[model samples]
Target chain A: MDDQDQQLVFINWLEDHSASVMKVARAYTLNSEDCQDLAQEILLQAWRSVPKFSGKSTAATWFYRVALNTAMNWKRKDKPRRESQQPLIDINVPEPHGPDSSERLLHQEMIENLYQAIHQLPKTDAALVLLYLDELSYQEMAEVLGVTENSIGVKLNRAKKKLATILNGGCDES
Target chain B: MNLDEYRQAWKEDEAQMNITFDSDLLSKEVLRSHQSFQSMIYWRDFREVGVSLVMIPLWLLLGSMMSLPWTWYLTIPALIWIAAFIFVDRSRHPQRPSHPGEPLLFYAKESLEQTEHQIWLLRNIFWWYLLPFCISIMAFFVNVAWNSSDGLLGFSLLSGIGAIFLYVIYSAVYRLNQTAVTEQLEPRRDDLQRLIDSLERETDDENAGDIMELVAAISESESGCGACSGWLNWAENWNRLVPSWQTATAIILPTLAGALCGWYSGTQLQIPEMGPTLFQVIVGAVIPFEIVFFSICWSSSKKQKKIQVARDEEAASKPEDRIKTTSSDNGIRLPKAPALVILVLVIFLGVMAFVAIGAFFLHMKEDLNAHNAQVIKRSFHCTNRV
Candidate 1:
């Protein structure tokens, strides 16, 4: 397809799935600025990769794989850049917001807490947790993660337990 | 919270996630990255071809200036070998369009074919490289030996053995590269393949296999099997005999080396001016044997692995026979070393040492007689002077 046509399709997909990139960036980076850079990279990659999309996988699966892969690579590349000047920024800690229903606010707190727990995970485990939180099926997660289904089952189980421990504040025990 | 509770929260948050980049900037970035990616691939291929083209002429010039009659002839065979190597390599994996950017199955297929080609080169590298290399070295040796009346026989013997050493190096390199492919690359390739295969299978496309088979057949027909077909068919038995060959070399070479060192020390034969010191000869004989023997043993360990894979495949294909075959033979085991073999080796070395020692004393006797005659002549001269 022509550039104009491709861009139109990409804009539509980006509008739908921009959150996946942002989420992956959050997990990968140490700050909002790095997250912005990573998400932009993911968007660019997705645009380049859209032509090769075989439609063998769901759009979400494709987006998650692209965003996660791009973010992971950006983190690896940007590490030295970060280490040279500033201290590491913790992106997983939620911004303090004001005014919402108590129930909605509680759920938001739980989600933020869950992301914090995931952020502290090993990179791959964090990815598994992200996919798990998205409620992707084992097969879809396997495709996105490039992990075997059987291995994913084991890793996902471990990741869930780890998340639970973190959420329970088990590590906080003296 | 559990994922079930987290799902509602994700839905709410996802709605608010913004597209941080404007379309104009995103489009510019996308176009630029794609352009750079294409250029990078082209540069890689260009650099490889450019270096190779330059080196070919340099090697030819160096060979010509080498101090032997056959050195100039080296270029012809060298040229032929390079042409054949490239031809056979290309034919073995008919040049496919590269897919650097694709992921999953496309990546898998590309990676698989590239590695398979590498493995093929590793397998048959002797024909492309070592054989010609041996021939060139043999030519140089023959030319030098022909000038020495008695050294010609020794030269022939050493050159023939040298070719075997070249073959050993070829096998060791091939098996090493093969092991890497088996251990590391194959699993990733298989995983990607499995994913692709599952997707295809889910579509209930029964004819997918036939279509893929047809494509494979066409590609394979255009490509030779990366071997000298005639030689391969003839030497298929060599694969089975490889263990015995290693055993023979381990026992024979060390004894031969010891005998040569002993004979040279006895002054039985004049060593060649270039690279024929007893130490060099012994090391040359012993080292290649050691290299060949060790690699053969290493490759043999891989046989048990292959057997496991085979057993699994067999079980999958025919489940009824699984119980019976559980205790079946793993791939051809290296035969146990019998007592008689060790005894025979000891006897051979003993006889070699005896010959070497006997020659040394016999030569010493001649020197002693010559010394006695000189002493007698000196005594006669003194008596005449008085």
Candidate 2:
């Protein structure tokens, strides 16, 4: 209804979704500092873009779209051209974790494995996997990707298999 | 190891994470970048101001010289030199065409060609008009020196008329040959107009839509946009008449007083039957000031009238866009006393005129002494006459 109302809603949405998007962003960024920077950048884009949202898709879907677009474009453009290269973090999963913390460590290792597997996939497939993980409907994903829902469905199926193969350590290099 | 495990961990991290940010600090960076981007658009105009300042002295010097009552011999050559310089300047550094529809790589080529075509008309002012007039003036001076006043007067008038004729000719040539130059120039002008329009667009709380929408609404307004509005502002209020008036006065007043003094003093010197020389001194003095005074007044009045029309057009513009409450400096003072102030001004002018007349009388006496000395030296050398 007004600027203050819109800003409050945007901030609330940003706070709720920031951690989820930050983890996705971490999969691509190399270090703790880069992860923090990427997360802030995503938040910034969401702030600027919220005023223009037509609401054809859910807010989460729009957020995922902007985040993925910003991340992929940044990685592609920034990687070799920029001199300051900070590679992704090497998160070490310690042996069998502490006696009481084995489950949490195992869960962290699985998430790390998912991130590694996603990185090995082509950019478009990786984006598809990330959107699917965010639980965006096929139609909502289509709007973000600027493609048909049927096409998104097809891409998702192919991406899932690629991701599966990558996770299994039998990923096709091509 | 599985999707469920990854999902569960993601849920855990999402729930546990809490990040703090100071938005005002972050937005300051964003605002800084926007300001940087906005500042770039004015770089060219800033350069133009610098260039114009450099040209001001040169323009004033030439303008004053143009008003001098020296024999046509000196005036003609000076005009020619000025004409050549203008031609060279126009030819070498034409006004760059600032806009064309972009297919990016080809845009430069098309715009460059348009710039060239624009300079074609510019060249007409320099070469065809100014050059021919200068040459004709020189030719007239030579004819007058050879005892042909009728020929000199006829050719001088021809040269003056030729300047206008050349401008018309060139304008026609541009119309026929370079229609695209005119069309391409319009959009660049429009872009400036749009920028000005956007600046003035309402950011008031009552307005709907985003900044972009506000910009669009402003573009659609009857004032026909911001850049157009600025042009209207310039065309109306900034058509400076006073500078030309000052220039004309400076050149004319001194020379006119000098000529009348020259004639009166020369007559007193009793130069045997040289009525024409005395008349020449008087007419010469009066002609230059009259020409300069009348020319400046005519040009300034023409510009003023044109500006008045432009102002009227701008006044007709009604921007229904919500008015932005800018931090307007209210202390800008309008000049008081208006035309009535001229009563006091005339007193000062009269005193200056009297001083100028006195100076001219002194200069005329010196001229007479120099002439008598030359005649005495000639007489001493005339052995057969002695």
Compare the candidates by lDDT and give the number of the best one.
Answer: 1
* Candidate 2 per-residue lDDT over residues B271-371, each given as its tens digit: 63343344446544655655664565588789777976775455334222111111212132222332223223335444544344334433443555677
Q: Score the docking of each candidate (DockQ).
A: 0.07, 0.04
Report the C-alpha lDDT of model 2 over A1-174, residue by residue, as the tens digit. 465666687767756775665666665554444454455545555555676676766776677766754454332112111112122112222344466577766665676677767656655566677777767788777666555566565556666766777776654323
| A62-130 per-residue lDDT for model 1 (tens digits) | 887766555443422222222221211112323336665666668666766666666667555677788
* DockQ top scorer: 1
Give a tens-digit lDDT track for model 1, residues B1-386.
Answer: 35555656877677644444467766765555455445443444444344445556655554443322544356465655666566555556654433223333443355456645655665566677666766775675455444322365776775666566666876687677668667754554454355445323423332222111101211211111211222232233233334354556665666576556644653545543322243344444445545654565576658746965775465344422210101111132222343235345446544534343333333333454566788899999999999
Off by over 4 Å in 2: A1-3, A75-99, A171-174, B2-5, B27-30, B36-386
- Model 1 TM-score, 2 decimals: 0.47
| True A-B contacts kept by model 1 | 0.11
The number of clashing residue pairs in each candidate reads 0, 5
When candidate 2 is compared with the true two-chain complex, its DockQ is 0.04
